[model samples]
Target: MIYLQLFWEFFKTGLFAVGGGMATLPFLQAIGESTGWYTYTDLMNMLAVSESTPGPIGINMATYVGFTAAGIPGAVVATIGEVTPSIIVILIVAAVLHSFRNNPYVDHAFYGLRPASTGLIGAACAAVVLEVLTSIQLVAQEGGILKTAALTLDAAAPLGGVLNLRGVALAAVLLVLTNWVPKVKGLHPIVFIGLSAVVGVVFGFAGV
Candidate 1:
């Protein structure tokens, strides 16, 4: 039963999350909340691991969540479910795409999906930012998302104070390096991810 449920949930996610891997973040977040198999923090961690690993982020996330919920079998089921929609859609599209390549309706349909994808990705980014750089919801737990706003770096205060100052600082440095730095900007992204992972391991994330 758990396996079936996992498959159904991820199947729906794969069917609707059309933008790409990043766009699936919102669906995965809701899945985590509704299923109760994992928490928001767990989802964030999964996102981090998924981003760092090989293969598509969406599939990796599905497998990870499934494994957490059940085990190896759950992972297989969830992964298959996640890819089924894509396979079906791709096959159908391939069959008719040549015939309808210039159809106005089809063009409009694809165009309509753009905004939905953009909105999903944007929301995902906002959620990630909040989860990573702020301690608002982490401290709240079951209290509420905005229960309190800690505005200090007093680690001894409560819930690591308002924000993850170190995380924010690291993000700033990375942004500058990846976007503004002369030679650094050209380096592959894996280098940054690896560095960030090392930094996280060495420093660790405490309250925030």
Candidate 2:
């Protein structure tokens, strides 16, 4: 039953998250809230893990969530669920694409979807920002009233005050190295991802 639920949930996520992997973030966030299998903080960590690992981000996230929910079987079900929608949609579209090839209505519909996809992807990105920044300094499991109040107020603070500077700095450095350095610009994403993982380990050890 749990496996089936995982499949259904991820299937829905993959069905409507049309703009690629990043776009699935919103659906995954909602799933975290709805299922209680994970938390927003878990999603943030999963994003990091997904970005650093092989395969599409959405599939990787789905597998991770599924594993958390129900171990190996959950992972299998979730992965299949994520890909099944795309396969069905593509197969159907391919069968009728020739007919719709010249249809202006179809063209207009796709045009409309472009903006909607962009909006969904943008919202997902914003949600990522909110989760990371809010959790980094704001989350408090236990504390005295003064400490709790301070944490709450800190969480509500806008911008960099609530942001995780270490994570932000790491990202900025990687971006600069990967984009600005000619020798590194051609490096595969996986290479940089591995480097990021090493950096993450170091950060963890250093208590950053």
Please list the C-alpha lDDT of all candidates, in the order they appear: 0.83, 0.81
- For model 1, what is the alpha-carbon lDDT of residue 158? 34
- Kindly list the per-residue Cα lDDT of model 2 for residues 1-208, writing each as its tens digit: 8987998999998899987887899899999899899999999998999987778788899899899889999999999999999999999989797779899998999899999999988977765775554443334345555434234445444343656666678778888988999989789987987887898797772354
TM-score of each: 0.57, 0.52
Worst lDDT 10-window in candidate 2: 147-156
Backbone clash count, each prediction separately: 0, 0
Cα lDDT for residue 91, model 1? 95
The superposed Cα distance between candidate 1 and the true structure at residue 155, in angstroms, equals 11
lDDT of 1 by residue, 9-32 (tens): 989989999878877888888888
